[model samples]
Target: MARMRIQDIAAEAAVSPSTVSKFINGHYDAMSASTRSRIAEIIERTGYRPSSVARNLRLDRSRMIGVILADIRNPYSSAMLGELADRSAAAGYTLTCAISGNNPSKEAEAVMRLAEAGADGLIVNTCGGNDELLADTCDRAPVVLLDRDVPGASIDLVTSDNGCLVAALLQEVMRDGVDACWLLDEHNDASSVRRERTATFERGLRSACARGGCIALARNACAAAAQLTKMSCSSGGSPIGLIAINGLVFERLVEALAVAGIDVPGAARIATIDEYPWNRVLFGGVTTAAQDIAGLAAAALELLIERIERGRGPCGSRRRIEIPGNIIARRSTRTDSGPTTTTPQPLRAHR
Candidate 1:
């Protein structure tokens, strides 16, 4: 029982060693269909597994991609990670994942550890506070940011278009007798996607001759709940719209509304960004803006692979990709008008 190398596999397929190596590494541009099939058949029949370590040593690439998520408990994070894993494997790469739990210190540690481990590149859903470390790491490896973007980091970013979707949702809510809207967010940090959505909501309210404000649910859900209650009461019985920044905040707002005996579409209307399974079942199907999880994963992978295959470009010319999300109008924000659902659209990448 001896090990088979690339030369043996190439000999059986009647191809050169470089061709077999290219096949293993997924470089099929110059390869023909019949040649690919013959090589694949031989490799499958011989059970020839390529040695990743040896290949990496020769190629100077680990074939390992590092992924950092702020929190995996959130449905969007889990879904996006699953998509990334599947796509990475098909592209002949493995993924090493880390959860920062939204702690800056933990996130910094993960970034350094991954870089030291010789990861070919990194796809980070940053929690902020690591701009300096992230920027410095760019000199060592290619980095593609996911979800939240970090300022001053010159890294390629792939994120959902928050402002446009929020404006569309606000327009729908205003038609449902919602004179005042409240933006509920768990954090006010730069890492939070709430920043863009909150700004868009405010502008939408002002344009429509409506009023609204932001409530910081930062580390104190109870205080936020009380503030919401007070705001609702002082509105003089006018219907108020409540917009949760993400799924985590949406869950808390739902619980708080139930405890306060407030009814959806009756006492106050409620909706949120980031669609989840629970959202479709709660409160007669909650209204939501669903980000294209698949698109985000694919775009991020494309950017990382490009940088890995090619060399780094000018930092000032870094790419920033924004994928549009769909708005699902359900009963939560329902009025006399019928429910509607918007179709998901293609993405736009900017530099």
Candidate 2:
């Protein structure tokens, strides 16, 4: 149905535009009960909606928040979205989500579309490569980044403490007495968090063993399995530890290990950066560092709403907040049949 304007609504209801305006703004003191009912029926029948642009122009606010995710298929993104929606609703704001599918151009388009649609603020999980566009967008509406950062852009960021989490995970894995560590990841040029974690893993692995490196992931699960088999055979009979970069990588790695018929924590040890529901049972509880999705969502929404209420500030001044994650140790990374152990880290903030 075509969206009817206030003038059209007024004409159909046989009321003046002023009366319709007052009704929309909830000032019903002057209108009779019959007139109010008639206007409501007209609005419902016509499917009329007040123009957000016009409302924002007049009231200087939209009471709406926009969320742009690089890919909602990621469990992290989906979970965080739910938290953001609930929190925004409680704060009297509506949320609209756009999926970028990890495309930089699509991400830039989403930014423009959300801003033009009159979002009071934006929470973006960027796919990178749009630093300039994001910086320009900050001038029009507040933009708070989630899970990623653009070094060229001075924007607020809320993400997990990847360095500390990776360090802790590595420390635990090294305690298992593995001969080498290998990080399996897809091409992560567009993801800042993945890149940072990869670097941290490499640094920690080399410092501990001097026998590990980052390995590229293959799209085909069977091919990945062959790669793992080759790595295992070349490890000189010493057990090597494998680290999956994220949830997607974790799934593929698990399938590959299964295909290769390699026993967990026996032929090889496995751990991942992101957690999943099956992490506990699938292959006997894969060890993982679970990102604090709830905390990240709350912090991002709080930062964005706080900025919106305080008005836009100087573009040069920015904030970066990192919520710590939990490293859960399980059978995947240990040879013992003991219970799970969780190590909670501390939160950190950077300007």
Candidate 3:
């Protein structure tokens, strides 16, 4: 069968191709209800699918954006990407995703590929080491950094407030009067988010020490687990609390703790930065700083559109949007309260 075209649909409906084009583009302000109904019926009967490529070319724009993520394996990054796609589609734009796998060379290559493919804009969750390449890319297209920031890059950014999130989590741990606190990270120099998280953890620890609480930092999950085991064995059983920087760090910590036969709220307490469905099911529940996924998506899209419409030139001023996350209280950190079950909630997405 021959592929249907806009002219074919217009001819069958007895309307001009321009009218059909306007209807397809959703410009129905001055269109009559009868005409609109006729076009809709004709389109359904003919099973016509509009050519996005042709329409985009006619507009002299690609109407497509690229989203470069540091690691698609991370639950937080995955959730944010899903929200961005939904919100971008609602705004009549399409999204293409690229994963850098936390490598600087891979990240630079992804940026170049997306630009070569004629993407109108880019939203990136940076891998923390692509400063020069990212700066150059911003000169070629509108780029919005998300979740992580690249230093010396003069692009708009959307991320959660790191300082506030850590402070809130620390407040809960200190209030419970845990014996010792530990901060766990997979590697020290992975991404900007992890760096900021580590800095905040140190500041929180200083504050906790001022209040007379013991605190320490672990280079890797294995080291953290070793320390937990040593403390548990030496003290003949004392309560130790740990704050895992992110989901990956949390997983390693859980595995190590399980291997050592550590009990939650009995031998140790756990808190993490981001929470997903599995976290809730694992130890009954875990406390976390849930990132504002929808807010970040909305901010990223608005920034990208603003830059694209502003035309070719340096941004008038650097814009940084910090979306505040919420602290989810659960059974992992609860001492006197025993294990309690809470209904599993679906993650929120951008509209």
Candidate 4:
């Protein structure tokens, strides 16, 4: 609803334009007491307010936070959104959320637009581009990096513990007697999360005797997988197991395996980096390092709000927080037996 205006109040009160302006602008010293009282009564009855005056009165407050998600298609992103919404509402702030479709340029546009529209703070799933713009924007308002991060940018970050998680998962696969393992990572520059995952996997490998073979799923995941296997067998080689980088990659691996008539954990054992709600029901279940979506979401919201409300100064120096997740062992990574009864628990891979 439109707010009451000073003109509406003056017309109703039958007063000169200057008289009302003086009264509204708090210049009542020259006005008679009766006239001042009349204007006040009219304003009270009509609920009149000057938009510009009101805006100037509370220039420090907007009560709105903006969110720039890298990709809404991610199930983790969806879960984080719901959690962020709940926390924002509880903290008396509304949210303006936008998706970047994992495009850096679109991410920059969304961030700039939201800030221009007066968002008090921002939570960004950065597409790993526009570092300069992101840093500059952070100077205006608190920018919390969610899930993914930008290189050489000092900003508050909340992400899963991909390092420890990956290392542990790889150790477990080794103990399971898998001769060779290949990690199917979608090549991209927009995701630091993927980079971290890949680095941890490489460190764990340490130039093992057995390596992996598979390449180019851009044209078609299934076709690419078919070609990868055909080439491997032709060259007298095969991957004993495969580790999918994330859910999308995992889905592609599943599709490829199905099309090539390769039984998971049989023809080729399988494990993935992300665990979804549907993981348990798929392919006799899948082994995955589960991300703590709720924990990450809550941490991101809390950290950004703290910086916004508590003041962004020396104490608010950019902080990076990593929350660990469970390594859920499902049948997809089994080496000997078939799929068994599934339970939600963290696998004992540390020992």
TM-score of each: 0.86, 0.82, 0.79, 0.76
Best by lDDT: 2
Candidate that beats the other on lDDT, 1 or 3, i.e. the better one: 1
- What is the per-residue lDDT of model 3 for residues 100-152, given as tens digits with 9 covering 90 to 100? 99887898999999999999999988887778877888888889899788776
TM-score of candidate 2 on Cα atoms, chains taken together: 0.82
**Model 4 stretches with alpha carbons more than 4 Å out:** 1-59, 213-219, 227-239, 335-351
Quote the lDDT for 336 in model 4: 64
Report every candidate's CA lDDT: 0.84, 0.85, 0.77, 0.74
Q: Where does model 3 exceed 4 Å of error? A: 1-51, 210-224, 231-237, 310-313, 337-351
Q: Of models 1 and 4, which has the larger TM-score?
A: 1
Can you write out model 2's per-residue Cα lDDT over 190-267, one digit (the tens) per residue?
Answer: 488878888888888777754778887786989999989998898888777888877778878988988899888888
Lowest lDDT 10-residue stretch of candidate 4: 342-351
TM-score of 4: 0.76
- lDDT of model 3 at position 255: 80
Tens-place lDDT digits, model 4, residues 1-351: 666676766777788877898897799888889889889998887777666535534657687899989878767778789989998999878988999987878988999999998888899988876788988999888899997876677788898877777776676555455656666767564378877777777766765554553333433766857754763464344336677777777777777776777766665667777667678887778877888888988899899889887876662377888877877776767646654433223323321
Best by TM-score: 1
lDDT of 1 by residue, 1-351 (tens): 689899998898899999999999899999999999999998888888988789789989999999999999778899999999999999999999999998989999999999999999999999988888998898779999997888767888998888778887777666656789878877545554667777778887888887777776544556656777887897799878888888888878877886667788787888888878888878888889888999999999989999998977888868888888889998888855555789543322333
Cα lDDT over the full model 3: 0.77
